[model samples]
Target: MNKTVIIKGMSCRHCAMRVEKALNKINGVEASVDLESRTAKLNLTNSISNQQIIEVIDGVGYEVVEIIDV
Candidate 1:
């Protein structure tokens, strides 16, 4: 499964990489963050909830704008 996470308060590549690392730490999740789009594209190899995804981003000090399934 794949999803897109729209995030707020990310200003540069550092911020983007931070979020990317945080999300990637989660089991069964792979993410790539794009600074320009302020988004993270997520690939799930196992069952995962949107709430879990949101919390990971939030725990890293970023606001989650939205999550869309794709």
Candidate 2:
């Protein structure tokens, strides 16, 4: 499954990278963050909950605006 997550508080590539790294830490999660869009595109190799994803991103100091299947 794939999901596009709209995030806030990412201003540069480094910030995006941080979010990506944090998310990618989860088992079976592949994350690519786009600084320009303030969004993270996630590819899930296993089932995961939206709240779980939200916690990871928020834990890294960003706000999760929304998540949608893509």
Candidate 3:
């Protein structure tokens, strides 16, 4: 499954990397963050909640604006 999350406050590559790392910490989740679009593309091999993803991103000082299953 794939999900696209719109995020805010990502200013640069470092910010993008931070969000990517936080998402990747979840089991069966692979994330790539793009600062240009202020979005994160996630690949999931297992079930995970949208709130979980939001919390993870929020925990790292970023904000999840929206989550869309794709």
The C-alpha local distance difference test score for the whole of candidate 1 amounts to: 0.96
lDDT of 2 at 67: 100
Q: Candidate 2 lDDT, tens digit per residue, 4-25?
A: 9999899888999999999999
For residue 19, model 2's alpha carbon misses the true position, in angstroms, by: 0.1
lDDT (Cα, tens digit) per residue for candidate 1, span 1-70: 9999999999989999999999999999999999999999999999999999989999989999999999
**Estimated TM-score for each candidate:** 0.97, 0.97, 0.97
Question: In model 1, what is the error at residue 30, expressed in angstroms?
Answer: 0.8
Model 2: lDDT of residue 70: 94
Model 3 TM = 0.97
- Model 3 global lDDT (CA atoms, 0 to 1): 0.95
The candidate that wins on lDDT is 1
After superposition, candidate 2 runs with Cα above 4 Å error? none
Angstrom error at residue 29, model 1: 0.5
Query: What is the total number of backbone clashes in candidate 3?
Result: 0
